[model samples]
Target: MADNRKRRPINRPKFHHTTFATTKLHEMVEFYEKVAGLEPVHYGDEAAWLTNDDANHRIALLALPGLKLPQDKGHTAGLHHTAFEYESFDQWIDNYLRLKADGIVPFLNLDHGMTMSMYYQDPEGNGVEIQVDTFGNWHASKEWMWYSAEFAKDPIGAHFDPDKIAEARERGLSFEEIHRRCREGEYKPEVIPEVYLPEFW
Candidate 1:
Protein backbone atom coordinates (compact mmCIF):
# COMPACT_ATOMS: atom_id res chain seq x y z
CA MET A 1 0.00 0.00 0.00
CA ALA A 2 3.08 2.25 0.21
CA ASP A 3 4.88 4.06 -2.62
CA ASN A 4 8.09 2.03 -3.03
CA ARG A 5 9.54 4.25 -5.77
CA LYS A 6 9.77 7.18 -3.37
CA ARG A 7 11.92 5.18 -0.96
CA ARG A 8 15.54 6.23 -0.72
CA PRO A 9 18.43 6.30 1.72
CA ILE A 10 17.77 8.64 4.66
CA ASN A 11 21.33 9.82 4.95
CA ARG A 12 23.13 9.47 1.66
CA PRO A 13 26.88 9.41 2.03
CA LYS A 14 28.88 11.78 -0.15
CA PHE A 15 31.48 10.46 -2.54
CA HIS A 16 34.94 11.64 -1.58
CA HIS A 17 37.48 10.42 -4.12
CA THR A 18 38.79 7.50 -6.10
CA THR A 19 42.20 5.83 -6.33
CA PHE A 20 43.75 3.64 -9.00
CA ALA A 21 46.75 1.33 -9.07
CA THR A 22 48.70 1.56 -12.30
CA THR A 23 52.17 0.98 -13.59
CA LYS A 24 51.99 3.96 -15.91
CA LEU A 25 51.83 6.86 -13.46
CA HIS A 26 52.75 9.67 -15.84
CA GLU A 27 50.26 8.63 -18.50
CA MET A 28 47.53 8.26 -15.89
CA VAL A 29 48.28 11.70 -14.48
CA GLU A 30 48.10 13.27 -17.92
CA PHE A 31 44.87 11.47 -18.69
CA TYR A 32 43.29 12.56 -15.41
CA GLU A 33 44.37 16.17 -15.92
CA LYS A 34 42.85 16.29 -19.38
CA VAL A 35 39.74 14.24 -18.68
CA ALA A 36 38.94 15.09 -15.05
CA GLY A 37 40.54 18.58 -14.98
CA LEU A 38 42.57 17.45 -11.97
CA GLU A 39 45.91 18.89 -10.87
CA PRO A 40 48.55 17.39 -8.68
CA VAL A 41 48.34 17.94 -4.92
CA HIS A 42 51.32 15.74 -4.06
CA TYR A 43 53.01 14.10 -7.03
CA GLY A 44 55.99 11.78 -7.25
CA ASP A 45 57.33 9.03 -9.49
CA GLU A 46 55.79 6.31 -7.32
CA ALA A 47 52.53 7.97 -6.33
CA ALA A 48 50.49 11.08 -7.04
CA TRP A 49 47.43 12.75 -5.60
CA LEU A 50 45.28 14.96 -7.83
CA THR A 51 42.29 17.23 -7.30
CA ASN A 52 40.12 19.70 -9.18
CA ASP A 53 38.52 21.29 -6.13
CA ASP A 54 39.30 22.09 -2.49
CA ALA A 55 39.01 18.46 -1.48
CA ASN A 56 42.84 18.19 -1.67
CA HIS A 57 42.53 15.06 -3.76
CA ARG A 58 39.74 13.56 -5.79
CA ILE A 59 41.76 10.87 -7.48
CA ALA A 60 44.98 9.04 -6.68
CA LEU A 61 47.03 7.16 -9.27
CA LEU A 62 49.72 4.90 -7.87
CA ALA A 63 52.52 3.01 -9.57
CA LEU A 64 52.60 -0.72 -9.05
CA PRO A 65 54.44 -3.47 -10.92
CA GLY A 66 53.72 -7.14 -11.50
CA LEU A 67 50.00 -6.41 -11.55
CA LYS A 68 47.87 -8.18 -14.09
CA LEU A 69 45.60 -5.99 -16.18
CA PRO A 70 41.93 -6.98 -16.18
CA GLN A 71 41.34 -9.62 -18.80
CA ASP A 72 39.16 -8.73 -21.75
CA LYS A 73 35.90 -10.71 -22.30
CA GLY A 74 35.90 -11.98 -18.70
CA HIS A 75 33.73 -11.06 -15.71
CA THR A 76 36.03 -9.25 -13.30
CA ALA A 77 34.57 -7.75 -10.16
CA GLY A 78 36.53 -5.12 -8.29
CA LEU A 79 35.83 -1.61 -9.48
CA HIS A 80 34.11 -0.74 -12.75
CA HIS A 81 34.96 2.97 -12.82
CA THR A 82 34.15 6.40 -11.41
CA ALA A 83 31.89 9.08 -12.87
CA PHE A 84 32.12 12.87 -12.74
CA GLU A 85 29.26 15.26 -13.39
CA TYR A 86 29.03 18.66 -15.03
CA GLU A 87 26.45 21.22 -13.96
CA SER A 88 25.55 22.60 -17.39
CA PHE A 89 24.87 21.11 -20.80
CA ASP A 90 27.11 23.69 -22.49
CA GLN A 91 29.98 22.84 -20.21
CA TRP A 92 29.44 19.15 -20.90
CA ILE A 93 29.48 19.76 -24.66
CA ASP A 94 32.68 21.80 -24.42
CA ASN A 95 34.39 19.04 -22.47
CA TYR A 96 33.29 16.48 -25.03
CA LEU A 97 34.62 18.55 -27.94
CA ARG A 98 37.90 19.23 -26.12
CA LEU A 99 38.38 15.55 -25.52
CA LYS A 100 37.46 14.80 -29.13
CA ALA A 101 40.00 17.27 -30.48
CA ASP A 102 42.68 15.65 -28.34
CA GLY A 103 41.79 12.20 -29.73
CA ILE A 104 40.10 11.20 -26.48
CA VAL A 105 36.55 9.99 -26.99
CA PRO A 106 33.95 8.05 -25.09
CA PHE A 107 33.40 4.47 -26.10
CA LEU A 108 29.74 4.60 -25.09
CA ASN A 109 27.30 7.48 -25.14
CA LEU A 110 23.75 7.01 -23.92
CA ASP A 111 20.62 9.01 -23.23
CA HIS A 112 19.35 7.58 -19.93
CA GLY A 113 16.23 9.83 -19.95
CA MET A 114 17.37 11.59 -16.76
CA THR A 115 20.98 12.02 -17.91
CA MET A 116 23.20 12.08 -20.96
CA SER A 117 26.34 10.05 -20.25
CA MET A 118 29.58 9.45 -22.12
CA TYR A 119 31.72 6.54 -21.03
CA TYR A 120 35.44 6.55 -21.82
CA GLN A 121 38.19 4.00 -21.40
CA ASP A 122 41.09 5.12 -19.24
CA PRO A 123 44.71 4.22 -19.85
CA GLU A 124 44.28 1.16 -17.64
CA GLY A 125 41.04 0.08 -19.34
CA ASN A 126 38.93 1.66 -16.61
CA GLY A 127 35.67 3.37 -17.52
CA VAL A 128 35.23 7.08 -16.84
CA GLU A 129 31.78 8.54 -17.35
CA ILE A 130 31.06 12.21 -17.92
CA GLN A 131 27.39 13.07 -17.60
CA VAL A 132 24.96 15.97 -17.42
CA ASP A 133 21.48 15.83 -15.97
CA THR A 134 18.84 16.33 -18.64
CA PHE A 135 16.36 17.66 -16.10
CA GLY A 136 18.67 20.40 -14.75
CA ASN A 137 18.11 19.50 -11.07
CA TRP A 138 18.44 16.36 -8.97
CA HIS A 139 14.92 16.66 -7.62
CA ALA A 140 13.40 16.56 -11.10
CA SER A 141 15.82 13.87 -12.23
CA LYS A 142 15.11 11.62 -9.25
CA GLU A 143 11.39 11.90 -9.82
CA TRP A 144 11.74 11.05 -13.51
CA MET A 145 14.06 8.14 -12.84
CA TRP A 146 11.66 6.79 -10.26
CA TYR A 147 8.39 7.10 -12.13
CA SER A 148 8.93 7.78 -15.81
CA ALA A 149 7.49 5.10 -18.10
CA GLU A 150 10.30 5.82 -20.58
CA PHE A 151 12.86 4.79 -17.98
CA ALA A 152 10.93 1.62 -17.29
CA LYS A 153 10.81 0.79 -21.01
CA ASP A 154 14.56 0.91 -21.60
CA PRO A 155 16.83 1.84 -18.76
CA ILE A 156 19.96 1.07 -20.77
CA GLY A 157 18.94 4.09 -22.80
CA ALA A 158 19.29 5.10 -26.44
CA HIS A 159 22.81 5.26 -27.81
CA PHE A 160 23.69 8.58 -29.42
CA ASP A 161 26.49 10.39 -31.22
CA PRO A 162 28.54 12.99 -29.35
CA ASP A 163 29.08 15.05 -32.49
CA LYS A 164 25.37 15.11 -33.18
CA ILE A 165 24.65 16.22 -29.63
CA ALA A 166 27.23 19.00 -29.87
CA GLU A 167 25.79 20.20 -33.15
CA ALA A 168 22.30 20.26 -31.72
CA ARG A 169 23.44 22.29 -28.72
CA GLU A 170 25.39 24.68 -30.88
CA ARG A 171 22.42 25.20 -33.16
CA GLY A 172 20.45 26.62 -30.25
CA LEU A 173 18.40 23.52 -29.60
CA SER A 174 17.11 23.59 -26.06
CA PHE A 175 18.24 20.83 -23.73
CA GLU A 176 14.66 19.64 -23.41
CA GLU A 177 14.23 19.54 -27.15
CA ILE A 178 17.47 17.69 -27.71
CA HIS A 179 16.57 15.07 -25.15
CA ARG A 180 13.15 14.62 -26.68
CA ARG A 181 14.67 14.21 -30.13
CA CYS A 182 17.20 11.75 -28.76
CA ARG A 183 14.49 9.62 -27.23
CA GLU A 184 12.67 9.71 -30.55
CA GLY A 185 15.87 8.31 -32.12
CA GLU A 186 16.94 11.36 -34.12
CA TYR A 187 20.56 11.28 -32.92
CA LYS A 188 20.96 7.55 -32.55
CA PRO A 189 24.28 6.15 -33.71
CA GLU A 190 24.57 3.59 -36.46
CA VAL A 191 26.53 1.22 -34.29
CA ILE A 192 26.67 0.95 -30.54
CA PRO A 193 29.75 -0.78 -29.22
CA GLU A 194 29.30 -3.66 -26.80
CA VAL A 195 30.59 -2.93 -23.33
CA TYR A 196 33.34 -5.31 -22.24
CA LEU A 197 32.87 -7.01 -18.90
CA PRO A 198 36.11 -7.65 -17.01
CA GLU A 199 37.25 -10.95 -15.51
CA PHE A 200 38.94 -10.90 -12.10
CA TRP A 201 42.34 -12.57 -12.41
Candidate 2:
Protein backbone atom coordinates (compact mmCIF):
# COMPACT_ATOMS: atom_id res chain seq x y z
CA MET A 1 0.00 0.00 0.00
CA ALA A 2 1.29 3.47 -0.83
CA ASP A 3 1.34 6.09 1.88
CA ASN A 4 -0.07 9.37 0.52
CA ARG A 5 1.62 11.29 3.34
CA LYS A 6 5.01 10.30 1.90
CA ARG A 7 4.54 12.93 -0.79
CA ARG A 8 6.41 16.10 0.28
CA PRO A 9 4.55 18.69 -1.83
CA ILE A 10 0.81 18.38 -2.31
CA ASN A 11 0.24 17.24 -5.88
CA ARG A 12 -2.10 19.66 -7.56
CA PRO A 13 -4.39 18.46 -10.26
CA LYS A 14 -4.77 20.53 -13.43
CA PHE A 15 -8.24 21.93 -13.97
CA HIS A 16 -9.44 19.96 -16.95
CA HIS A 17 -13.07 21.03 -17.34
CA THR A 18 -16.26 22.38 -15.78
CA THR A 19 -19.83 21.19 -16.19
CA PHE A 20 -22.92 23.39 -15.90
CA ALA A 21 -26.49 22.22 -15.56
CA THR A 22 -29.00 24.64 -17.01
CA THR A 23 -32.63 24.82 -17.99
CA LYS A 24 -31.62 26.85 -21.02
CA LEU A 25 -29.04 24.36 -22.20
CA HIS A 26 -29.07 25.48 -25.81
CA GLU A 27 -28.70 29.12 -24.93
CA MET A 28 -25.94 28.29 -22.47
CA VAL A 29 -24.13 26.28 -25.12
CA GLU A 30 -24.44 29.11 -27.58
CA PHE A 31 -23.06 31.53 -25.01
CA TYR A 32 -19.98 29.35 -24.46
CA GLU A 33 -19.55 28.86 -28.21
CA LYS A 34 -19.49 32.61 -28.73
CA VAL A 35 -17.88 34.01 -25.59
CA ALA A 36 -15.40 31.26 -24.78
CA GLY A 37 -14.47 30.53 -28.41
CA LEU A 38 -15.50 26.92 -27.87
CA GLU A 39 -17.01 24.45 -30.33
CA PRO A 40 -19.30 21.54 -29.68
CA VAL A 41 -17.33 18.38 -30.10
CA HIS A 42 -20.40 16.21 -29.49
CA TYR A 43 -23.68 18.02 -28.96
CA GLY A 44 -27.13 16.67 -28.20
CA ASP A 45 -30.41 17.97 -26.80
CA GLU A 46 -29.89 16.70 -23.28
CA ALA A 47 -26.15 17.35 -23.06
CA ALA A 48 -23.26 18.99 -24.94
CA TRP A 49 -19.53 18.90 -24.50
CA LEU A 50 -17.38 21.70 -25.90
CA THR A 51 -13.72 22.54 -26.37
CA ASN A 52 -11.47 25.29 -27.68
CA ASP A 53 -8.27 23.25 -27.82
CA ASP A 54 -7.39 19.62 -27.91
CA ALA A 55 -7.84 17.88 -24.55
CA ASN A 56 -11.22 16.48 -25.35
CA HIS A 57 -13.78 18.85 -23.74
CA ARG A 58 -13.39 21.93 -21.61
CA ILE A 59 -17.05 22.67 -20.94
CA ALA A 60 -19.97 20.33 -20.53
CA LEU A 61 -23.59 21.44 -20.57
CA LEU A 62 -26.37 19.31 -19.18
CA ALA A 63 -30.02 20.05 -19.80
CA LEU A 64 -32.49 19.88 -16.97
CA PRO A 65 -36.07 20.29 -18.05
CA GLY A 66 -38.66 21.96 -15.82
CA LEU A 67 -35.87 23.22 -13.61
CA LYS A 68 -36.66 25.94 -11.15
CA LEU A 69 -34.33 28.77 -10.25
CA PRO A 70 -33.30 28.80 -6.62
CA GLN A 71 -35.36 31.20 -4.48
CA ASP A 72 -32.28 33.38 -4.07
CA LYS A 73 -29.20 33.36 -6.28
CA GLY A 74 -25.67 34.51 -5.37
CA HIS A 75 -26.36 32.73 -2.08
CA THR A 76 -26.59 29.18 -3.34
CA ALA A 77 -23.58 26.95 -2.82
CA GLY A 78 -22.25 26.16 -6.29
CA LEU A 79 -19.85 27.31 -8.94
CA HIS A 80 -19.72 31.10 -9.03
CA HIS A 81 -17.81 31.52 -12.29
CA THR A 82 -15.45 29.91 -14.75
CA ALA A 83 -12.44 31.70 -16.21
CA PHE A 84 -10.58 31.41 -19.50
CA GLU A 85 -7.13 32.89 -19.94
CA TYR A 86 -5.95 34.38 -23.20
CA GLU A 87 -2.30 34.03 -24.22
CA SER A 88 -1.69 37.69 -24.91
CA PHE A 89 -3.06 41.14 -24.16
CA ASP A 90 -3.64 41.76 -27.87
CA GLN A 91 -5.65 38.59 -28.17
CA TRP A 92 -7.74 39.44 -25.10
CA ILE A 93 -8.39 42.99 -26.34
CA ASP A 94 -9.21 41.79 -29.82
CA ASN A 95 -11.65 39.26 -28.42
CA TYR A 96 -13.28 41.91 -26.23
CA LEU A 97 -13.75 44.21 -29.22
CA ARG A 98 -15.06 41.39 -31.39
CA LEU A 99 -17.62 40.47 -28.75
CA LYS A 100 -18.47 44.15 -28.33
CA ALA A 101 -19.15 44.39 -32.05
CA ASP A 102 -21.36 41.31 -31.70
CA GLY A 103 -23.38 43.20 -29.06
CA ILE A 104 -21.87 41.28 -26.15
CA VAL A 105 -20.08 43.23 -23.45
CA PRO A 106 -18.53 42.43 -20.11
CA PHE A 107 -20.58 43.56 -17.12
CA LEU A 108 -17.44 44.21 -15.11
CA ASN A 109 -13.77 44.73 -15.89
CA LEU A 110 -11.04 44.77 -13.26
CA ASP A 111 -7.26 44.72 -13.00
CA HIS A 112 -6.57 42.06 -10.32
CA GLY A 113 -2.90 43.10 -10.12
CA MET A 114 -1.95 39.57 -11.16
CA THR A 115 -4.47 39.45 -14.01
CA MET A 116 -6.46 41.99 -15.96
CA SER A 117 -9.92 40.43 -15.88
CA MET A 118 -13.24 40.94 -17.64
CA TYR A 119 -16.48 39.47 -16.33
CA TYR A 120 -19.46 38.52 -18.47
CA GLN A 121 -22.80 36.86 -17.94
CA ASP A 122 -24.20 33.98 -19.96
CA PRO A 123 -27.77 33.62 -21.14
CA GLU A 124 -28.53 31.66 -17.98
CA GLY A 125 -26.99 34.44 -15.90
CA ASN A 126 -23.92 32.42 -14.98
CA GLY A 127 -20.84 34.58 -14.41
CA VAL A 128 -17.72 34.07 -16.50
CA GLU A 129 -14.34 35.71 -16.11
CA ILE A 130 -11.94 36.24 -19.00
CA GLN A 131 -8.40 37.15 -18.04
CA VAL A 132 -4.87 37.76 -19.25
CA ASP A 133 -1.82 37.40 -17.03
CA THR A 134 -0.40 40.92 -17.04
CA PHE A 135 3.04 39.75 -16.07
CA GLY A 136 3.01 37.62 -19.22
CA ASN A 137 4.16 34.44 -17.45
CA TRP A 138 2.68 31.96 -15.00
CA HIS A 139 5.62 31.93 -12.59
CA ALA A 140 5.79 35.72 -12.15
CA SER A 141 2.03 36.09 -11.95
CA LYS A 142 1.85 33.30 -9.38
CA GLU A 143 4.52 35.00 -7.33
CA TRP A 144 2.73 38.32 -7.52
CA MET A 145 -0.56 36.75 -6.54
CA TRP A 146 1.16 35.29 -3.52
CA TYR A 147 3.26 38.22 -2.25
CA SER A 148 2.52 41.46 -4.10
CA ALA A 149 1.35 44.31 -1.86
CA GLU A 150 -1.01 45.50 -4.57
CA PHE A 151 -2.88 42.20 -4.57
CA ALA A 152 -2.76 42.06 -0.78
CA LYS A 153 -4.35 45.51 -0.47
CA ASP A 154 -7.54 44.76 -2.41
CA PRO A 155 -7.80 41.30 -3.86
CA ILE A 156 -10.88 42.22 -5.89
CA GLY A 157 -8.76 44.84 -7.67
CA ALA A 158 -9.68 48.13 -9.33
CA HIS A 159 -12.19 48.60 -12.12
CA PHE A 160 -11.11 49.66 -15.61
CA ASP A 161 -13.02 50.93 -18.59
CA PRO A 162 -12.80 48.26 -21.25
CA ASP A 163 -13.42 50.75 -24.07
CA LYS A 164 -10.65 53.06 -22.92
CA ILE A 165 -8.27 50.11 -22.57
CA ALA A 166 -9.08 49.08 -26.12
CA GLU A 167 -8.40 52.65 -27.27
CA ALA A 168 -5.09 52.62 -25.40
CA ARG A 169 -4.12 49.39 -27.13
CA GLU A 170 -5.02 50.92 -30.49
CA ARG A 171 -2.83 53.94 -29.70
CA GLY A 172 0.24 51.66 -29.18
CA LEU A 173 0.55 51.36 -25.42
CA SER A 174 2.31 48.23 -24.18
CA PHE A 175 0.46 45.83 -21.90
CA GLU A 176 2.72 46.60 -18.95
CA GLU A 177 2.30 50.34 -19.41
CA ILE A 178 -1.46 50.05 -19.62
CA HIS A 179 -1.52 47.84 -16.54
CA ARG A 180 0.44 50.45 -14.61
CA ARG A 181 -1.91 53.19 -15.72
CA CYS A 182 -4.96 51.13 -14.78
CA ARG A 183 -3.55 50.31 -11.35
CA GLU A 184 -2.77 53.98 -10.77
CA GLY A 185 -6.45 54.88 -11.50
CA GLU A 186 -5.89 56.54 -14.88
CA TYR A 187 -8.93 55.05 -16.67
CA LYS A 188 -11.72 54.89 -14.12
CA PRO A 189 -15.06 55.32 -15.86
CA GLU A 190 -17.46 58.07 -14.79
CA VAL A 191 -20.13 55.50 -13.95
CA ILE A 192 -18.52 52.36 -12.61
CA PRO A 193 -20.16 49.09 -13.45
CA GLU A 194 -21.99 47.21 -10.70
CA VAL A 195 -20.95 43.70 -9.82
CA TYR A 196 -23.24 41.12 -11.42
CA LEU A 197 -25.82 39.55 -9.11
CA PRO A 198 -28.33 37.15 -10.67
CA GLU A 199 -31.93 38.39 -10.79
CA PHE A 200 -34.92 36.68 -9.15
CA TRP A 201 -36.68 35.76 -12.36
Candidate 3:
Protein backbone atom coordinates (compact mmCIF):
# COMPACT_ATOMS: atom_id res chain seq x y z
CA MET A 1 0.00 0.00 0.00
CA ALA A 2 1.18 3.50 -0.74
CA ASP A 3 2.00 5.71 2.22
CA ASN A 4 -0.83 8.20 2.74
CA ARG A 5 0.99 10.57 5.07
CA LYS A 6 2.57 12.69 2.39
CA ARG A 7 1.02 16.05 1.53
CA ARG A 8 1.76 18.38 -1.34
CA PRO A 9 1.69 22.15 -1.60
CA ILE A 10 -1.39 23.48 -3.34
CA ASN A 11 -0.70 24.87 -6.75
CA ARG A 12 -1.97 28.33 -7.82
CA PRO A 13 -2.86 29.20 -4.22
CA LYS A 14 -6.27 27.52 -4.62
CA PHE A 15 -9.31 29.05 -6.28
CA HIS A 16 -10.11 32.58 -5.12
CA HIS A 17 -13.08 33.56 -7.29
CA THR A 18 -14.02 34.00 -10.91
CA THR A 19 -14.56 37.22 -12.76
CA PHE A 20 -16.73 37.69 -15.81
CA ALA A 21 -16.41 40.54 -18.24
CA THR A 22 -19.78 41.47 -19.64
CA THR A 23 -21.19 44.19 -21.83
CA LYS A 24 -24.13 44.48 -19.49
CA LEU A 25 -22.69 44.48 -16.03
CA HIS A 26 -26.02 45.18 -14.36
CA GLU A 27 -27.63 42.18 -16.05
CA MET A 28 -24.73 39.98 -15.00
CA VAL A 29 -25.00 41.31 -11.46
CA GLU A 30 -28.73 40.64 -11.40
CA PHE A 31 -28.31 37.09 -12.70
CA TYR A 32 -25.71 36.23 -10.08
CA GLU A 33 -27.68 37.92 -7.33
CA LYS A 34 -31.01 36.22 -8.03
CA VAL A 35 -29.76 32.83 -9.14
CA ALA A 36 -26.69 32.16 -7.03
CA GLY A 37 -27.75 34.13 -3.95
CA LEU A 38 -24.77 36.43 -4.15
CA GLU A 39 -25.13 39.71 -2.30
CA PRO A 40 -24.17 42.68 -4.35
CA VAL A 41 -22.11 44.69 -1.92
CA HIS A 42 -20.82 47.35 -4.27
CA TYR A 43 -21.94 48.41 -7.70
CA GLY A 44 -21.52 51.10 -10.31
CA ASP A 45 -22.72 51.46 -13.87
CA GLU A 46 -19.82 49.37 -15.18
CA ALA A 47 -18.81 47.05 -12.33
CA ALA A 48 -19.96 45.29 -9.21
CA TRP A 49 -18.68 43.18 -6.33
CA LEU A 50 -20.85 40.34 -5.09
CA THR A 51 -20.23 38.30 -1.96
CA ASN A 52 -21.73 35.16 -0.53
CA ASP A 53 -19.84 35.06 2.72
CA ASP A 54 -16.85 36.68 4.42
CA ALA A 55 -14.81 36.91 1.25
CA ASN A 56 -14.28 40.47 0.14
CA HIS A 57 -15.63 39.53 -3.23
CA ARG A 58 -16.39 36.12 -4.60
CA ILE A 59 -17.55 37.11 -8.07
CA ALA A 60 -16.75 40.32 -9.86
CA LEU A 61 -18.71 41.66 -12.79
CA LEU A 62 -16.95 44.12 -15.03
CA ALA A 63 -18.53 46.02 -17.86
CA LEU A 64 -16.74 45.98 -21.16
CA PRO A 65 -17.50 48.48 -23.87
CA GLY A 66 -18.15 45.92 -26.58
CA LEU A 67 -17.88 42.40 -25.26
CA LYS A 68 -18.71 39.93 -27.94
CA LEU A 69 -21.38 37.36 -27.32
CA PRO A 70 -19.94 33.97 -26.36
CA GLN A 71 -19.95 31.37 -29.09
CA ASP A 72 -22.18 28.41 -28.36
CA LYS A 73 -19.65 25.86 -29.65
CA GLY A 74 -18.58 24.99 -26.04
CA HIS A 75 -14.91 25.84 -26.41
CA THR A 76 -14.01 28.28 -23.64
CA ALA A 77 -10.45 28.73 -24.95
CA GLY A 78 -8.50 29.36 -21.75
CA LEU A 79 -11.03 28.64 -19.01
CA HIS A 80 -12.55 25.18 -18.77
CA HIS A 81 -15.04 25.73 -15.98
CA THR A 82 -15.50 27.13 -12.47
CA ALA A 83 -16.88 25.11 -9.57
CA PHE A 84 -18.45 26.17 -6.26
CA GLU A 85 -18.51 24.03 -3.14
CA TYR A 86 -21.48 23.56 -0.81
CA GLU A 87 -21.19 22.13 2.67
CA SER A 88 -24.35 20.06 2.67
CA PHE A 89 -26.28 17.87 0.27
CA ASP A 90 -29.47 19.65 1.22
CA GLN A 91 -28.01 23.03 0.35
CA TRP A 92 -26.86 21.61 -2.93
CA ILE A 93 -30.37 20.40 -3.62
CA ASP A 94 -31.77 23.75 -2.69
CA ASN A 95 -29.49 25.47 -5.16
CA TYR A 96 -30.44 22.94 -7.80
CA LEU A 97 -34.12 23.49 -7.23
CA ARG A 98 -33.71 27.24 -7.29
CA LEU A 99 -32.09 27.02 -10.68
CA LYS A 100 -34.86 24.75 -11.85
CA ALA A 101 -37.56 27.00 -10.45
CA ASP A 102 -36.15 29.81 -12.50
CA GLY A 103 -36.65 27.62 -15.59
CA ILE A 104 -32.93 27.11 -15.86
CA VAL A 105 -32.14 23.47 -16.46
CA PRO A 106 -28.62 22.32 -15.85
CA PHE A 107 -26.57 21.27 -18.83
CA LEU A 108 -25.82 18.05 -16.97
CA ASN A 109 -25.94 16.26 -13.66
CA LEU A 110 -23.23 13.72 -12.85
CA ASP A 111 -21.97 11.38 -10.17
CA HIS A 112 -18.17 11.46 -10.32
CA GLY A 113 -17.57 8.89 -7.52
CA MET A 114 -15.87 11.51 -5.40
CA THR A 115 -18.36 14.23 -6.19
CA MET A 116 -21.86 14.74 -7.51
CA SER A 117 -22.27 17.76 -9.75
CA MET A 118 -24.58 19.83 -11.90
CA TYR A 119 -23.17 21.68 -14.88
CA TYR A 120 -24.58 24.87 -16.28
CA GLN A 121 -23.74 27.83 -18.43
CA ASP A 122 -24.12 31.39 -17.30
CA PRO A 123 -26.07 34.01 -19.26
CA GLU A 124 -23.03 34.35 -21.48
CA GLY A 125 -22.30 30.61 -21.76
CA ASN A 126 -19.47 30.57 -19.27
CA GLY A 127 -19.29 27.02 -17.94
CA VAL A 128 -19.94 26.54 -14.25
CA GLU A 129 -20.10 23.56 -11.93
CA ILE A 130 -22.32 23.39 -8.85
CA GLN A 131 -21.03 20.39 -6.97
CA VAL A 132 -21.16 18.52 -3.69
CA ASP A 133 -18.38 16.23 -2.61
CA THR A 134 -19.18 12.68 -1.46
CA PHE A 135 -17.02 13.41 1.59
CA GLY A 136 -14.93 10.20 1.39
CA ASN A 137 -16.41 8.03 -1.35
CA TRP A 138 -13.72 8.56 -3.98
CA HIS A 139 -12.56 5.40 -5.69
CA ALA A 140 -9.18 4.51 -4.23
CA SER A 141 -8.46 1.29 -6.07
CA LYS A 142 -7.21 2.86 -9.22
CA GLU A 143 -6.75 6.22 -10.92
CA TRP A 144 -10.18 7.86 -10.87
CA MET A 145 -9.06 11.11 -12.49
CA TRP A 146 -9.57 9.47 -15.84
CA TYR A 147 -13.26 9.41 -15.02
CA SER A 148 -13.13 13.11 -14.20
CA ALA A 149 -11.57 13.83 -17.55
CA GLU A 150 -14.29 11.83 -19.21
CA PHE A 151 -16.87 13.86 -17.35
CA ALA A 152 -15.21 17.08 -18.43
CA LYS A 153 -15.13 15.94 -22.03
CA ASP A 154 -18.87 15.46 -22.04
CA PRO A 155 -19.87 17.69 -19.16
CA ILE A 156 -23.54 17.36 -20.07
CA GLY A 157 -23.85 13.66 -20.91
CA ALA A 158 -21.24 11.51 -19.23
CA HIS A 159 -22.12 8.12 -17.82
CA PHE A 160 -23.35 8.46 -14.25
CA ASP A 161 -25.70 6.04 -12.52
CA PRO A 162 -27.51 7.35 -9.47
CA ASP A 163 -28.73 3.94 -8.26
CA LYS A 164 -25.24 2.49 -8.32
CA ILE A 165 -23.93 5.38 -6.23
CA ALA A 166 -26.85 5.15 -3.81
CA GLU A 167 -26.12 1.49 -3.30
CA ALA A 168 -22.49 2.23 -2.51
CA ARG A 169 -23.54 4.83 0.03
CA GLU A 170 -26.20 2.58 1.55
CA ARG A 171 -23.57 -0.06 2.12
CA GLY A 172 -21.70 2.37 4.35
CA LEU A 173 -18.65 2.42 2.14
CA SER A 174 -15.75 4.63 3.16
CA PHE A 175 -12.66 5.96 1.42
CA GLU A 176 -10.55 3.67 3.56
CA GLU A 177 -12.59 0.70 2.38
CA ILE A 178 -12.24 1.79 -1.20
CA HIS A 179 -8.54 2.37 -0.71
CA ARG A 180 -8.08 -1.11 0.71
CA ARG A 181 -9.79 -2.66 -2.26
CA CYS A 182 -7.84 -0.42 -4.62
CA ARG A 183 -4.61 -1.64 -3.06
CA GLU A 184 -5.75 -5.09 -4.18
CA GLY A 185 -6.63 -3.64 -7.58
CA GLU A 186 -10.20 -4.83 -7.36
CA TYR A 187 -11.84 -2.16 -9.48
CA LYS A 188 -11.38 -1.18 -13.05
CA PRO A 189 -9.68 2.14 -13.68
CA GLU A 190 -11.96 4.83 -15.00
CA VAL A 191 -11.44 5.82 -18.62
CA ILE A 192 -10.78 9.25 -17.14
CA PRO A 193 -10.68 9.60 -13.36
CA GLU A 194 -11.56 12.72 -11.38
CA VAL A 195 -9.41 12.37 -8.25
CA TYR A 196 -5.66 11.85 -8.04
CA LEU A 197 -4.04 9.40 -5.65
CA PRO A 198 -0.50 9.95 -4.46
CA GLU A 199 2.23 7.37 -5.12
CA PHE A 200 3.87 7.67 -1.73
CA TRP A 201 5.26 4.48 -0.24
- lDDT: which candidate is best? 2
Q: What is the lDDT of residue 172 in candidate 2?
A: 93
lDDT of 1 by residue, 72-164 (tens): 522456666688899998899899999999999888888898899998877787888899998889999999999999799899898899899
Instruction: Give the C-alpha lDDT of model 3.
Output: 0.60
Candidate 2 residue 161 C-alpha distance from true site, Å? 0.6
lDDT of 3 at 179: 29
TM of each candidate vs. truth: 0.87, 0.90, 0.61
- Model 3, 1-201: lDDT tens digits are 988774876564766678888776776777777666788889988888998888888998888787766553353345655777676665765676677678875555555545666666666656567776655333541245555575456433333332333344457765445323423334433443332111111
lDDT at 8 for candidate 3? 75
In candidate 3, how many Å is residue 14 off? Answer: 4.4
Best-to-worst ranking by TM-score: 2, 1, 3
Write down the lDDT of every candidate, Cα atoms only: 0.86, 0.87, 0.60
For every candidate in turn, the CA RMSD to the true structure comes to 4.2, 3.0, 10.9
In model 3, how many backbone clashes occur? 12
Name the top TM-score candidate: 2
Worst 10 residues of 2 by lDDT: 192-201
